[model samples]
Target: MDEQHERADGPFRARGGPPWRRGGPPPWAPGPSWWDHRADGGRLPWRSTVLVTVIVLAGSTMAAHGRAGDRVGLDVFAYLLLVLASVQLLWRQRYPVVIVYGTALCATVYLAAGYPYGPVFLPVALGCFAAIVAGHRYAAWGAVALLWAAHTVVGHWLYGYLPPPGDGPAAWAQEAVVAAWVLAVVAVSELVRVKREQWAQARVERERAARRRADEERLRIARELHDVLAHSISVINVQAGVGLALLDSDPEQARTALTTIKAAGREALGEVRQVLDTLRAPGEAPRAPAPGLDRLPELVEQAAGAGLTVGIGTGGKRVTPAPGADLAAFRIVQEALTNVVRHSESRRAHVQLDYRQGGLTVTVDDDGPASHAEAGGSGNGLAGMRERAAALGGTIEAGPRPDGGFRVVAELPLAPPAPLSEDSR
Candidate 1:
């Protein structure tokens, strides 16, 4: 495992980076909000501030010139309109609707008061953009319609003038142009929404995959622990039984039994630590050599040392199998031997391994008491061995044999089928 993925006892930590900074800005921080972080005191760039200041100054100059010539009073209302509209740019993302509608109203008033189109119309158009970025598509369209209607109604009712019949087409055409501009804004914002949704879903899938992998790793660790601990414990159980029975008659042999117990404990601890170290960092731990068919003789010898008459025989060339198949073979034999010690009343058992061309076959038969059949028929051990064999696409059969003994026979494929890697499990 990588250091970033180390499994410590603590709060859960998210395993990936933020969604932003991947080419385009994330949807939540798009448009004006992207620049929101760049501003000092949350103010616009100096260039925009200077431009707005220059526009206000130019508007005041025009109003002052007109007032001096006695053509109009200095339009204090117009100056206020320009200030209100320009200030709205600052709050475009925070209060998009309020700023847009406010700027639109100010622009309408300024235009109705006979101010030039340059400064007044600029903010009005920019407000439409702010509304789109805020995802108010319908509201923006309504605002566009209202602007056109207000321009026509104010011109006719207050000024006593209307667009001529042929001029009506030109007026409607201008409304269409504004509609197209709003439509373009809507299209871009929707694309950003879709991109953000996909990014969010991808994050969810990645986390789900990580959790599944962690769970599988934990299960694998449990299986390894069961295999290593159960086998060694079974041997220790038989050895301790013999040592206790012969403590007075065979003192030296009993001391040897104690030594074997110590050795088994040390071996079990080392196996456990090796498993933990590998899980902690797969590359740091050395791989332990896997047990296979060749180890069956040693396994039988250990059982015999515990005073159970045991026999192991190989029927073929004893070829090495693939790793998965080898592990399955070892587990099958281990579980069978464990059952013979735990469940059988008889002291004599046979362990056989046949390495044929199609696959390897394992058989464990014990001639325990005739009534031992009823005692060991719980089937849990057998069921687990069967499941293990089935997982490797193999077959297992276990029950009472005809000659008053329990027999377990399993045939495992030499090469396991390809595992289902695509599935998260």
Candidate 2:
């Protein structure tokens, strides 16, 4: 990745799109809150547990009053059972199995004691829901099933032996109601579990997509900065050297070299500003059109200032390509010439533009005596060129020529030629 991207601005801001361009929850959309993260893990749910306990205690007391004659009244033992069941809910996130069993057992004992039934079942329902949602399905199901079975045996057969002295077997309709309630709890828990899993999966996908977008944007900015600075600086360097060499011996020539340096610097500043404007105000229209093949003449002029002669040639039919291919072709040629100016002792480079029925081909060649000693290039120009080409379903080949020079050839796909129709022919 070229390091031209501004880290502080971030990828979303650099893309010149709206605040919610991609991978972000839109402003109108509701996002997960701090409470939402508490679904499974994090801090213990202290406030919720205390609230449940309070409600259960008050409800159980009210039931004792409503059923004063039918069953045992709310005594200290009955109150303790309700508290135990509701309080165990605190650890449902971390120890759901234990809470499920504890609550289920507490509710069974209270019912077995012949106490009035009311909010006494609320804690058991909550425990089962938590356990199931926490993925302890078997434990939750078995705990509820065993509790219901124990209640059935006790209410029907063991009641005479254990509770309210002479209460007989529970009605079959009562067993049916209990079974229905258990089914409802499991169904609700399963629904919530599915929703939570989907939410988590979507969140993962969104984050992954956001990271990919950020990296691509960074690379693009880096490539642009590299090309702009490398080409312009190469020209400035050459001009500055000429200016110093002729400072006293040839005052007029030295002054011309300084002027060329200034021109190159100004042009570089303008292009750099254009590249950075996207990062600074991503939502605005560009200050200038992107450079394309039409700028090849300007590149030739710039290379001349760098003391490198460039010969441009064209073959095949000339046709306009898509905007992207035009830009890649231009940049590929620019970077190839910049590399030659910086690393080759040759004073002349050749650029060939071949437009074919299939696509556009750009080639840059420079004779070289391998000046690696003075080649201060960071080596990313060719990589950036290849990246630009590949992004447009194109290919790039760059290497030293077998006999003498370094060559860069790029094949960038244009829009498919429109189908021929009957015309003047």
Candidate 3:
């Protein structure tokens, strides 16, 4: 059977067994005959049904004509054998080997009874073809060998024994013809089986590739959302704490902190909404370009507003990286600064950007109190930063500094972006 059909059919059951064992309708049920449909849907197997029907009709007509001169009793028995053999062809695809065996047995009986040869051989030949096409190559060939032996032995018994050696070429030619026909059927069936398997394998690979793409897209969206929310929320958290502390003694400073918190919240909401909108409708134009090195000063200002004095320093000639690498670099710095504001109990932090020959390096260090030794030790923030760096073929290191406070360093390669395919355009 085709692999697709086999999967659809649920599982194999012993031939002629109870249908209920396989959760199928009884074999003799009158309504919507189980034999008329395949497992792929409830749709009728019209093509197979028509093919089997035509073969049976043609074979029966030829058999009746061949046996017209035989004894009435013998003719009736031959017709019975022909019917038995032909009826099973309908189920050849579902129980190919079984049908082959049954048809071979009926042919053997017909030959033994001395019925005249005509279409009596058709069913057995078709059964062999069906079995091989359904992936029972060995079984189909074995049945052919069995039928050949049965015919030879039965012919010798009914008629005079063959003359020794080179009496004539007629018998040899006949045997050769039968063998060639069976071999031809097997060869054709094998070719079709190989092609079917190749097609099925290709289909499976396509599905796997599609699933992998979906997983990567999901991860990209998650990373973007994490960067936006973590940084913005961290800034808001710090500003809110500062506002609460200064409310009584310094009303002006408290108002400034409140303004910073509101700004941070709005910015976070806008970026998050942009990410979500892109996810919801990918066909739309992108809301805005992603944050990159150009935004570092804004990030430093945000951190400063959150009560952390931040200093920025740069080295080497500045060069813009590819879009993906740029976004990764920006997120790494943002996440690091967010960690500084949230975890470090220090008043001062430093961000250093170094543009080198092949890549860019970002280092964030904070002079926080030693009591907060576990600051930025390990969490989703650091993990997200590491993931972003790694995706761009880069690396990140985060730990406490030997002097004081915590430090996070990321190195991002500045590779060119892959060109878009024509289909993408």
The candidate maximizing TM-score is 2
lDDT value, residue 191 of candidate 2? 91
List the lowest-lDDT window of 10 residues for candidate 3.
1-10
Q: List residue ranges in candidate 2 displaced over 4 A.
A: 1-76, 87-98, 134-139, 171-173, 415-425
Return the lDDT, model 3, position 221: 75
lDDT of each: 0.65, 0.83, 0.72
Q: Residue 128 of candidate 1: its Cα lDDT?
A: 65
lDDT of 2 by residue, 1-425 (tens): 24554333244465765445665544334222313443444778889999999999888888888987778777899889999999889878767888889999999999999998888888998989887776677888999998889888987788888767767788989999998998998889889877877786776556555665677788887888899999998899889989999999999999999998998899889999999999899789888999989999999999998888999999999999888788889889999999888889999999999999979999899988667657566888888998998788789999999999899999988873343332411
Q: Which candidate number would show the highest lDDT if scored against the true structure?
A: 2
Q: Report the Cα lDDT for residue 339, model 1.
A: 73
Show the colliding residue pairs in model 3: 1-134
Per-residue lDDT of candidate 3, residues 1-425 (tens digit): 00111111112233533354567753322122223345224444457656655665566566656656551234566667877887777677666778788888998887666555566677887788777765677888898789887776654553443322222223756767767876786787778767766776665455445555666676777777777877887788778878999999999999999999899989888888888888788789777877788888888788888777888999999988888888888888888787777676787888898999989899989886644444332357777788788777789999989888899999988885455553463
All candidates: TM-score: 0.64, 0.80, 0.77
Q: Which whole-number lDDT from 0 to 100 does residue 362 have in model 3?
A: 90
**Considering TM-score, which of the candidate structures 1 and 2 is the better prediction for this target?**
2
